[model samples]
Structures are given as C-alpha cells and as structure tokens.
Target: MAWGAAAILFCVWTLPFAELTGTSVTCTFSEDCVLPCTFKASSDEVIHWNRNNFIVHSYYHDADDLEKQDKHFEGRTSLFKDQIKHGNASLLLQNCNIQDSGQYSCHPSTTQGAQESWVDMKVHAPIRSVNIEKIDEEVICSSQGIFPAPNVSWTTDPPTQSDMLNNSTQTTQDPNGLYSVQSKVSFMGNVSDYAYICSVTSADGMQKWKTSMRQQGGNQLPSWIIVVIVVIGIGIGIGIGIWIGIWIWKKHQTEKNRDGVGNPGDQVPSGAFIAPGHDHVPPDEFGAEYELLTLWVTQKLTMPGTSQDPSAIREFRGPLEPSLRPDTIVSVTGLSQQTSLVQVGKSPC
Candidate 1:
C-alpha cells in the first residue's frame, strides 16, 4: 500500500500541471482595455504579464513592481491591486494604441501552482465619415483618422469596367498612427452621364463608409462658358434695343415731313401746279411732270372756241411741254367733247 501511494504521488507530480486559458480582446484606439486572467487563490500570490517576452506588468509581495516594464508600456500599464487576492490578475492597459495590438500572456503563481492565460488583443480605429467631391474632370474620395490602413473602391451608377476607370489611390499615416486615405478617379466623357460612388473599408473589414456624387446640370457647364453665354445674351439685347430706337426715330421723322407738306403756307417749286381748292399735293402721289401737263391741258380747254371734235385733236406745242428730239413728239388724242377731257401720262387732263 505504501508503494501504491508513492507511485500515485509520482504520477501526480509528473502529469501536465500548467493550466492555459485563451481569450480574445478587442480594444478601441486611445481607450483603456483589460486582459483577464484567473488563478487558484493563495496567500502569497505573484502575477506577471508579458507580450512577446517583454514585461508588460508584474506584481509581487502584495504590491506592484514595474522596474523591468517595457519602455513602450511605461505609465500605461497597471493591475487591480484589490482584486489580486481573489485570483484576478487582470491587466489594465491605458491609452491603447495600434502598436499595443498583439498576443499577451498573463502568468500567476501561488503555493498551489502556476497558470498562464493568453489574450489576443486587437486595436482598431474605425472608419468614420466619407467625403466625396467633384473637381473639374476628376472625382475625389477621402477619409481620415483610421487605423491599420484602409481600402478604397470606386463604382458608377452604370457600372464600368475596371480597366476603363482611370483611378489612383494613396494612404498616409499621421504622427498619431492613424491613416488617411484619398482616391481620385478621372473621367473621359461627360460628368453628368454617370453617378460616382466611393466606399471606404477598414483593414479588418469591420467598418465601412460610402459616399456618392452626381454632377448637377448647373455644375456641368464650365465657368468660362457660362460667362460667354451671358455676354452674348447682353450683346443681343443691346443690338435689338438700338435697332428699335433707330426705327422709332425714322418713323417720327417721316410723320413730321408729312405734316409739313400738308401746311397751307408751304411754298411749292416754280412751274409746279396745284389743283384748285387743294392745299398741297404730295410729290409721291403725282410727280411734277404730271402736274405741269395737267396745267397746260386745263388752260387750253378753258380758251374760247376750242375745237370740240375728237378727230380734230392733234399734237400741239405748249409752254409747259418738255423739249424733245424730232423723232419723239408729244401727242394728245382720244378727247371727249362733252367732258372736255383727255388722258395724259396715266392722269386725266
């Protein structure tokens, strides 16, 4: 029986004794995070947390000991001192950053045994707002304050081939280790023909943001083109105004001339005849030649004993008759004795 008990004690001591527990922890950038660990409770307890064999935090003798802590974790790591007796060896990491993301191991020891807990930490700065703008022939999409880099993609309402889309993207990291991404897509044809969409995704694919832009009709026209159109419109308006003003002035002059011609005191040129009881005969109606012919015919008809026979009427020379070559003679005929009248140059004589 002693041999059996000795063998059992040897077996217990030889068996695998180190307990290992693993969990995942997600942390937001610039925020506090806790890596949980638990062990068997004991009066004399010891705790140590390490990442990649680098000391993150250590506790012993019922107090914190950070003299050997990594420089990167200085003033940024702590332990829950009151909870250590309760088998809680959780590490409080302050102001978490992207560099702090990795696997961490928590080791706790006591009179009972020692155990190791693993925590996989991930630090993320999620994507926020996506901004899209159209500048000339290019469309730009951008986002700021992201962690672990980001991805950018461009799409159109009427989807286009990847090769056909002329695009370029760039990402930059600021001093705070946050990423800013910008993408530009150049278009060859009319901007109003398609709608451009830009999507920004975090590196971990846990967050996404999208923005779309469509060119409006007013925005499609170039600034210089708009200016030219306005200038042309003004020129046309001024030309029309000038033409109307000239037409009105000419019409006024014409009306004034007509009124002057109709005045009773207006003098007529010498040798020009005016019909009885008429103040004036506008030259536009009956020319000077016609008036002179009418006057000569009237004087001849008023003479006493003038021949009344139509056959006797023949060509006769008069004071008002215009001089003519021998080949061209003025002839007066087709007279009516009762009315004592003749036709001369389309006017009744």
Candidate 2:
C-alpha cells in the first residue's frame, strides 16, 4: 500500500510539467517583441529562457542572474520582474533582428513543481516600397529590405505572351539577412502602346507592393532634351523677328528715295535735278511741248547758282503760255476721263 501511494503521488506531481503547450510569436524587425510563458504561482520561483541550448535570460534568488547569457543577446533581453510572482515568465526582447528567429524554450520551477513550454519565433522585414523606372529601351523594377526572400514579376496593360516578357531578376542578401530584389525587362515595341507594372511580394505571401508607369504618346523625353528644344524654338522666333524688321526698314528707305526725300548724305548726279513736285505734273496739257520745257529747265539748272536758288528757277517762265485756251483744255478732257492734272503755274519744280 505504501509503494502504490508513492507512485500515484509522483504521477500527480509530474502531470503538469508533462502536458507542455506550444505557441507562435511573430516579431517585426527592429521592434520589441515578447515571448509568452506562464506557470502556477508558487514560492522559491526560478525562471530560465533559452534557445538552441544558448542562455537567453535567467532569474533566481528574487533577481536576474545573466552571467551565462549569450553574447548575441547580451543587452537585448529582459524579463517582467514584477509580474514573475504572478506566474508570468514572459521574456521581453528589444530590437529584434533576423538572427533571433527560431525555437525557444521557457522553464519555470518552484517549490510546487517545474514546467517547460515551447515558443516558435518568427522575424519578418516586410516589403516596404517598390519602384519602377524607364531607361531608353529597358524598364527596371526594384525593392529593398525584405525578409526570407521576395518574388518579382512584370506585367503590361495590354498583356502579352509570357515568353515575350524577356526579363531577368536578381536577389541579394545583406549582412543583416534582409533581401533586396531588382529586375529588368527589355522592350521591343512602342512604349505608348502599353503600360508596365511591377509587383514585389514577400516569400511568405504576407506583404506585397506594386508600381506602374506608361508613356502617353511616345517615349518620354529627358529633361535636358526638352530644355534644348524650348531654347531652340525661342531662338528661331527671335531670328524671324529680326529678319522682318530689316525688311521693313529697307522698304521704307526705298520709298524715301522715290519721293525725292532721301538722306542728306546721298549724292545726286550732274544735270539731274531733284524736282520736289514733278510727280504731280499733268502730261496731257503739255503734249509735245512738255519735252521742250523740260530741256529748257535742264539748261538753266546746269548753270551754277541756279540750282541753289529757288527764286532764280521760279523767275524764269517757260515757252508755254501761263494761260491756255479753254477749247484746248476741253479737247484733252474728252480723251482722258480719269486723268487729274495740276493747274498751270502750280510750281512743278
């Protein structure tokens, strides 16, 4: 009877520790996370947290004893000291990184009994931003700071055959175990005909990011090229304006010379006098006698001092009489209906 009672007591005391429970804990990269543990409240409590046989944290004698803590977790670990008395042995990890992911065991012992629990930890650096860029005949997609690995894919607005994509991808890991991905796709057709989309997804399928771009009418011009075109257009417009101004100035000079009002520096030929009002002379009244009058005036103009003195030229009366017969005027009027002639002695100098 004594042996039977001892066996039953041993089984009863060990039952709580034998029924171990497991839990999963997900932690964000570079953030604080807690590994949960619990046990029945008892006196003389002792708590220990470990991973892969490496010491993470320990507590005994009513205080933390970390003389054997792993170097990797030297200053990054802590326990809920005030809550330990209430059966809480949760481990608080600060600045969680990729290397902290794995299985961890929590052991809590007391005067009543001892128990062990398992916790699986996962550290994830989710996909943050995806970028798409076009360079000449190629399109590139890229992303950085992802955990595990990443999947990259390219698509078009007007979808094409998978074989026609002609793309290459590369993924690299940093010293911190975060992943970075880059992809490039060669384009053969017009850019305006289709839109390009880039998708980056985490390996665990928990995080994803997408970016897209397209050219409206044709391949987009670089900023330097657009600036050059605008500058050239402005230069052409200025050149045209200068050309038009020169043409107008030349036409004005020609009209001035024809009107006998040319510049002061212009030279006049000998025996060719400038007659200010000669353009207004009526040819019908003089008829054959007009040539004789012009020749007589040329002879006088050739004489020195006569060309300079307007009074001397006005004093001489031509061979034609100042007054003409009304019958002669009436006869000239009948032949030329549209002719408007200046009156005789109107000073056609």
Candidate 3:
C-alpha cells in the first residue's frame, strides 16, 4: 500500500524527536536560564531547537529562524517571547556561560501532529579559593577541588583555647606530596590569635568561600631564671658585710671601760685613799681634858692650811680613846679618829 504509507510517515517523523521530555536549567555567573519545553501545539504550530545536538532555534513558516549555533552560543540564544505564542517552545538564555551547560530539546510542528520537550542547563562559577598551613602548634584548614560539592565551615576570632574541627571532607598530605581535600582544624598554643576561616556553600545554598589565616607565636622569658636571681643577690651582699664588722668591735670595748683607761689622760693615784669617821668624846673632857685636847688638835693640823682641805674628809673615825683614871698619862700617838697628836696641857687626871 505504498510501502506501508512510507513506513507510517517515517514513524511520524521520528516520533517528535524521540518523545522529548526532561527539563532543568540553572545558572549563576551573570545569571539567567530557562530552557523548559512544553508543546500541545496549535496556534499555527512551529517550534524546534536542540543543543548538544546542534540546531540553534526555529519557528518555521511564520519565519523566526536560527541554526547551527555553537560558536560558544554566539550572542547567547533566546526564545521565550510569551511562551512562543502558546505553543510554548521555551529557551531564553542570556549571560549564562560555563559552556551553556548540558541537555536541551524542543519540537512542536502543529496542525495537530508533532510535539516534544526537555531541558537541563546549569552554569555557575563563583567558587573562590584558599588554603593555609602549619603543624605542631597547629593551624590547618582546606577547601578541596571546590565545585558543586561544597559545604565547609570553620571560623575563629578571639575564641580559641583548644579547638578541633572536621567537616567530613578530610584527606591530607602536603609539603609537596600532593593529595588534598580539606576542612579540618586544631588549635591551642595557649590561646590562638584571630582570623581563621573556611566557608563554602553555594549551589543555591547561599554562596560562600573564604579562607583567611593568622597564627602568632608564643612569648618567651627564661634565661636560667635570670641567672638564679643574680646569684641570690650576691649572697645577700656578703651577709650584710659581716654584720657591720661585729657592731664596730663591741662599741670599742664599751668606750675603753668608761675611760679608766689603758691609756688617754690617766691620773688619780696618790695612794688612792677613801674613808671617814669620828669617835664620841665629851666625858666632860676628862683625863686632863683629853690630854690638853690632843695637844690642841694636833697643833692645829700641822699649821699648813689644814693640808689644803679638799674637805679633808677621811683618814679615820673609830676606836682608841682611853685615858681617864689610870694615872691618865695619855700619851697616845697620832690618833686616826679625827686627828689627835696628843699633849697640849695634860690633865693626866
């Protein structure tokens, strides 16, 4: 019957481009993306487009054309002018780069006959970069390969007295050995200093990617404890100079025994004398009245100004006064009981 109606019109024109149906489009980087594709065609049906398979755009018969576009999608493709007038061919791409990301399709052809749809386009590029290091007094953090897979976290500022972290993306080996994937940390060199971060999360999870760094060294101070405090301050200044030389030699031997000196203006010697006394007399001055009063008080103290009387104190004052009635001869010698040399006018009573 005419070769089965030309193989049923060539399987109805390849079954509307193999029954297209898959859509998803996303962009980030001067943003803009749409690519959806729906077509229950009618309104003078006509729409066609493909990507990753060539053919740029079309709207046949009503004439709105484009094709073979791949010079980096020249001027950024387009279509969605009010859903291509109800037949909806969707496409609208602009400022979106990243190789205009994957899959896209559409095929309408009206007169109540063909239809198809599909789309999937994503293109984002804002991932920044950072990495820092130091170990054994730690300070390490990383951001692996960084792409759609990101969601790392770690931050510090004034707060760190022993911190540890690991956002599961761990794998390390640096110092030129190559092997990386990081977001791990450890700090506590007795209080770490500020600025330390590694934030990343963007697939519409609110973009981020910061990698700061800082780590000041510890303070120092021990030189054998300043040489043992200067050798205990020179042994307490030689024990206070031997206790001030034994207190100036016992105050110079108590001022030389109060100057009764071993030297220095010495004198006082004349038989070093000292004594004084006087016996009672008045027995009516008997016995020749005390032998003429001991020869008138020893001839008036030997007449030489009483020996320069320095109050002539002393020389005696006791025992030896007897001469009253025994023929009172009373010729006693130089009496020491208050001066008496005897015999002035005897009363030898």
Candidate 4:
C-alpha cells in the first residue's frame, strides 16, 4: 500500500494534476502563521499558493504554473520557501491587518495535494491618553482604554525626594481572546510634576510603549504660623509690662510731693537758745518768779527803763489800794498807821 501510494504520488508529480485535494493550516495575529500541505512523494516536487480564486505564487523548480494566476493575489502571497523545500506549501503574510484575515490555499503543481490556512488578525489597541491631577496636595494618575495596561511610576527632576510608584490592574478578556487592563497611581504632588512616566510592555517584553504627565502647583504652610503668633504675643506682653512700670514711678513721685517729707519748713533746727545773764541763774531760775514775769509780762512790755533806771521803776507804782482811782498807782514801803490820809488836789494855773 505504501508503494502504491508512492507510485500514485510519482504519477501525479510526473504527469499533470487537475485539482488539489485538502490542506491544514493555522494563524495568529500579526505573527507568522503556517499553511502545511503534504504529498506521498515530493523530494524534487515544487509547490505554489493561491488566495481566494487568485493564483498568488508558483514555485516548482522555477517553472510557470499557468493553470493558476490572479492579479489581485500578487505581492501579498508568497510560498514559505524553506517549508516548501520540505513539501510544506505555507504562505507568510507581512503586516497583517484585521482585513487580511481570511482563508488561503496552497497548490502544488509538481505534487498531488491541496493545503490551506485560516488566520484571524487582531490589532493591539494603544493607550488613548493619560491624565494627572492634584487631589488635596496629592497627585493621582489615571489611564484609560489601553489594552494590556501600562506600568505606572513617579519620578522627579533635580530629585528632591525619593519617588514611589504603584499600579492597579483590571483585566477583561473579549470573546476574540484579547486582554485589556487599567491602572492608577498616587504620588507627591510637588515632586510628581518633575517627570513622571507610564510604560506599557507586551507579554514577551520585546516592544515597549511609554507616556508622560505632570502634576501642577505645589506650595503650602505648616506649623510655623503658630510659632509666629506665639512670638507676637510675647512681644505685646513685654510692652504692657514696661508701660505699667513707668506709671508706677510717676505715682510714687506725686505721693512724695503731697506728704511734705522733703520740705525745709516742716523740720526743726538742732540747737538751744540762751540769754547772757540767764546762764548764771540757778537751774531753778527757769521756774522763778522773775523768769515767769519776764516770760509773761516783761517780754511783752515796751518799757525803756527796765534796762538802766531803778528810778524809772520807782516812779512806776507797785500796787493800787481799793479806794484808789482806776488809773492811780501806790507804794507801801516804810509806811505807818497814819491818823489821816492825805488827798492830792489838782493844780491850778
């Protein structure tokens, strides 16, 4: 049976074959796919590929296969030359868009079989936009519509402080077997504006995509305001103390003036006053009648005879009798009991 199969393959290859039978194939998005076909004998046989009623390529020992030709199939389809040598009539399509996805067939002019492949092309959706904004002195970044979400990072220019980057992922797989993710991050708003980057990488890490955003406006006041207020309060307290001290000094000076403490007339002189002859007078002379008379009557009298005239004093009456007139003066020295009293008469001119 193997020999018969080989003879049938040989007869098909040597002679011309009318139509192709069957082939198997598979395809991936934007990646090289395979369309493998087989025959019983094809050591020297060549193969060609056709797409949708169009002959795209023919490779049979550099011979033309006029039975299959299509103008629309040119330049887009080519036989996998390496695989074709191994009887694998595969086609490698470049830059496969979604529209390029379809069924393709392989035809072997020298061999006796038919092969084909079906591909479903998928386009990786890129990140639309990244936005960063300030949320109460903190920076928050959000990205949307990016299939296979990006890695988020927080960085700075001049590098004031260390950067911290965090990411959150949400994945959803579509019916077409494509994955999508979304992520966000929080950072210091002041430093976040320096330089921030979000990078997206494929599963294989071969192709990387990146985007950048900035945080706006960074300035705030802390506890130093409290310290300033405290300092001002102390200054006011000191000012009040100085004003009270000045007022107290003025009040003390006014009280001193009202009390007459420093007035000269209010103080007594420290000395004793004495008359010339009074020094020899007995100590009891201070209590004698003469001192008493001098203090009470002689000091007040303006008589000029008290200094040098005993006659002046004799002329001055010593005492007055009861019968004498109000102005009369009298003397009782060396007097006897007289028989009769004499009365003086007024002198006539």
Candidate 5:
C-alpha cells in the first residue's frame, strides 16, 4: 500500500501539469458522463487521456486516434472537439459502467510546454424496485438490472436477533452487463409475527438498500370489482324470486282446475247444468262465457210478447245448479234472415 501511494504521489509531482479542478464528478450507471479538463489549447496540440498508464482516448492531427486506446475502452470514450477551440478538452465517457470508476489523467502538450491534470470519476446505480410476489404459494423477493452484481438477502424488522434466513438465490448478468438477482425464503407459518425485507448491497459496498414487501400494500381484487359483483348477485337473486312467484301462481291455477273449482261466474262442475239469469259478480273474475249468456238472457226477458200464441212462449227444462249460469251461446253463422222464425226457450224442471 505504501509503495502504491508513493508511486501515485511521484507521478503526480513529476507530471508537467496542474490538478484537475473540483473534487470529483459523479455519474449514473449505463449513462454518459463528462470529465472536466479546461485549459487554453492550440488546434495543433496533441491531447492524451490515460488511466493506469492505459490510453483511454487520444487526439492528434485534428482528429481522434484509437490505435493505442485500451481494448476495454473501445468505442466508449471521446473528447469534446467543439469546445476544444475554447480550451475545453473534457472527456465524454459513453455508457458509464461500474468498471469505469477510477482516476483519469488528461494531458495536452505543445513544443513550448506540456500541462497535465487528473480527474476522479464515481459511477452509481439507481435503486431498483424489489418485487414481492407469491408463486405456487411460496413467497418470492427479487430485483433485476442492477450494476456490479449486488448482494441480496432477506431480513425482518422490528429487528430479529438472527438476521439470517434460509433461501434459494440466483444471480445472472443482463445483456447490458448489469445483474439480475432472485431470492426466495420458504414460509409456511407465523406470517403475522414477521414481515420480510429484501436487502441489496452493491458489490462495491457503498450502498445498502432494502424494500419491505408488506409496505407495498395488498394484491387482492379492487373494491369497485367487489361492489360490481355484489350488485350482479343481487340482480340475479331478484330475477330468480320473480320467476318462482310466477311458477307458483301457475301451479295453483292448474291445481284449482283439477279439483273442479273455477274462477267467478264460471260454468257449473262437469255433472251440473245452468239456467240463464243475471248473476252479480266481481268484475275482475267474470268469465267470457258467462258474460254472453247473461246478455242473451236479459234481452229475452225484455222483449215484447207479440207472439202471444202459447207455443210462441217456449221454455226448455233441465236440472240446474244455483252456482252455474247457462253458457250455451254458439254462432249459427249463416242463419241471420230467419231470426224471428226460430223459437228458442227454456224447459221447466
């Protein structure tokens, strides 16, 4: 460590340069970042950026040259030429990554004198949402697309004495070289006594992050859906009740007919007969047959006895029950012209 420190100090003191302005520039992972290096320069000067003696970027002859640039930084580093005329040779690092965090030296030299400066870069990862879900009835806690392969583990709080848990875990790299981590702890009993937390620590150990599954709220169906379901159920129930009432009413009517009972002003039971007369009845219960018979009988009783011949006042007789009114009105469809010649009558008992 002492040797390493001495070597760095010697390099800094020996360089024909000044310290880079400011402490450090911070950047997010998978983003672009700029390393500040401002100084007056001629378009003819050569500019070189190096990290640990490896060329990160080189500009000479008024253009960039990657012949000596490190393979690790291939196509990932460039210098600002538009501002270079204003003495700005700031380096733009493309797709900033965890491995890119380090000290970089920017040196521009002319025949008169060479000046150099060093800049520090710090790369960070934005915290990702940890997912909590139930798969096949087992609890799962997972995080994805994180940089530097974070450390993932389960914990509980209000702080349990033993912070460790038995779990299944896997870590995989994404296409962009970040990490995806999944971890699940077996849980069968006593959920109320404990709440789970998914904790992540970046490989560099600078970040400690945790997410609580319980704090994210419930996954049950929404309240509006429940309310809609209840309303639909009520509508179905009402429909069923109306259908039952109609069925019962029809069944009662069928049973009434079978037992030889009938609606008001109905004809007598099958073995009985009727004598026509006006019978008072409740309007809603009157049958069509009884209505015709009553009308015919009232007309006959009111007609003048112009045909005084004894045979003209004819009467036909039959056993009659008090409950039935005569209902024998049928159409003799083609006989209208002989109406007076036809003598219709009732027989005496």
Candidate 6:
C-alpha cells in the first residue's frame, strides 16, 4: 500500500505546466476555487482549462465547448466569457473536494501560437469535529471526512515517563477520495486523569482535539469526614465550656474571700476559710484545689470513727455536725504553702 501511494505521488510531482502563475489559490470545502490566468487573446481565440490532462473547462470561438469535458466536472466548471476581452482566463471550480487539489493550467491560443499559464489549487476540509473514547485502558481518537491526506498524530499530557507509547493509526479513503482517520493509544491498566491530544494538519492548516476519561463520582461531602468534623467540634465546645465554668467559679470565690466571707484565720458557720492572699493563682488551678478539698471531707464522713481512741486522734463520733474549731483548720497551698484540707467526722459503721 505504501509503494502504491508513493508511485501516485511521484506521478503528481512529475506533472507539467507551461508557467507558474501568481500563487496557489485556497478553497473551502464544498465551495468555489479560482485557478487564475491572464492572456491578451481576443474573444475569437480558443481557451482550454485542464488539470494534469483532465478536461476542466473548454471554450472556442467566443462560446463554451464541453463536448470533450470530463464527466466529474460536467456542470461544476465555468469560465467568465465577458472578462475574456480583459485578458482574464480564470476558471471557477465549484463544490471542490479532495480530488480537486492539483496543478491547473489554462491554454489560450491566438492565430499566431498557443500560450499557457498555470496555478495550483488547494481544496481544504479541516476536521470540524473529533471524538475520543477510552475503554479498559485503551484510548481511541477519531475524525472523519478530511481532505488531501491530512497528517495525524497522538500525544499524552502530563506526559508519561515511559519512552515508548502504545500508539497506532488507521486511515481510510472515502469514495470522494477524502480521509477518515482513527488513532489508538494504550497504557497500563487502571490509570486516571490522563489527557490525550490528537491533531491533523495539511496544506489547509491544522486542527486539534483534546480529551480525558476521568470520572467524578459525586459532589456531596463524605459521611465519615463530616462525622469526624462534627465530633471534633463538639469536643472543643465542651472543653471550652468547662474552662469557662472553672474560671467563673474561681472568680466568684476570690470576690467572696475579698469581702471577708470566710478568710483564713476567719471562721464561718458552715466551714472555715483559708487566707485570701493567693491572688496570683490561675482560675483553673484554684478551682481544682477547691474541688479536691470538698471531696476529701465527704469521703472521711462515710467511714467509721472513734474519737476516744488515741490512735484515731482526728476522728469524731457518729452524729457528727459541722463545727468551727481552731483545731479543725485546713491548710491551703499557694504563695504561702498554705495547704487546703477539710475536717472530717464519721457516722456509726
């Protein structure tokens, strides 16, 4: 297949023309393209337009002559007879397709001799649409109905470190000699978020398409993450509340002590108080010491006690009641090593 295509291209390269005209004229798909030429011939002179010996349009003696025209160009080729006197022998080819791209020549003959001028025609149909698909780690890219043997290539984005890529392409010519191309590239299984680019280029210019096959499951937040966040937030709120409560309690205690509600060396009916000089203590530490002292007194009262026994010197009898006694003083620790203690009396066990 390669050799056959090469031979066809060789023949095209060897095609002859009288002289090169201004420049190659470009035409869009299914549109008209002008193969321009100029001459000083009269309307009475004969003009012949052709592409590599294929009849495109013919005129003789001031009128069109299609008796020898090719069937493919039967009604789609025309010449402007009104402009012939102005030295314009341009030919208009309509509904241009891929096969219409080639070298074109206009031969205008006068009574003296035949003269020719030529221009190349480039008919283009860029790839207007492209589709890409991925199936089981294989990616396929395709574009259809392009013209003039377009160039096709495949590329990967976030380029793979692997030097070798599993890439392949297949191009088939249509009935109109246009092209349909498909490209495939493979990769290791189970890869995601990979992008691919496919491009086609020709004398008409270039066209490209990019695609990826990554799927996003959904937009909602995950249940586990949301649960964790709520739990953490609750824990923080509880911690803050406890801290605030302790601070409020300590502040109240300090205020009461300042007013001499129950200062150390001062006695109260329900309890004896320590000196209120530990103003430098933090609220949290002060609250902890106060709670510890309260718990110690409660525990001692639950146990049996015998006040008459020398070994139980601090013990008191059942039916104990709160009483302010000099020996019942509790030491509190602070700037003065003033420890906090609670007096205890026991019930019958």
Clashes of each: 0, 0, 5, 1, 7, 9
Rank candidates, TM-score, best first. 2, 1, 5, 6, 4, 3
lDDT for each residue of candidate 5 in 214-281, tens digit (9 for 90 to 100): 42333344567878999999999999999999999988774443233223453323212222353422
Give one digit per residue, the lDDT tens place, for model 4 in 66-103. Answer: 44656544455555555555556655565443444455
| lDDT (10s digit) by residue, model 3, range 57-159 | 7767666676556666667777766666576777777777655677777877676667677677767555556677654444566654333555667767755
lDDT (10s digit) by residue, model 1, range 1-349: 9999999999998764789989999999999999899988887898999999999999987988999999999999888888888988999999999999999999999987889989999998888788988777788999998988999998887787877779999999999899999999986475455778899988888788889887554336566788899999999999999999999998877544323223343332222223323443334443321323332223223123654545533322232433211212122111111112322222223
What lDDT score goes with residue 211 in model 4? 60
Model 6, 1-349: lDDT tens digits are 9999999999988764344345578787788877888876554678899878988899888889999998988899888878887778889888888777878888887664567777787877777777887655466878787776666666656676544567888989888777888888775444545566666665345655554543223122456777899999999999999999999998887644433223243222333323232323244544443322221121121124643345432321111234333324343333222345544232122
The residue pairs found clashing in candidate 3 are: 22-119, 23-119, 24-119, 277-317, 288-347
Model 4 ranges off by over 4 Å? 1-122, 148-154, 159-163, 166-180, 189-193, 202-349
Indicate the worst ten consecutive residues by lDDT in candidate 1: 331-340
C-alpha TM-scores of all predictions:
0.60, 0.64, 0.27, 0.29, 0.52, 0.49
Candidate 2 per-residue C-alpha lDDT over 1-349 given as tens digits, one digit per residue, 9 for 90 to 100: 9999999999987774533789999999999999999998898999999999999999996999999999999999998888988999999999999999999999999888888999999999988788888877788999888897899988888887778888999999999999999999877455576777888988888777889877568666766888899999999999999999999997877444333322444332222322223432345443421222322121123345554655533212123333322211111111222222232222322
lDDT score, candidate 4, position 43: 55
Prediction 5 TM-score vs. true: 0.52
What C-alpha lDDT do the candidate models reach, one value each? 0.72, 0.72, 0.54, 0.45, 0.63, 0.63
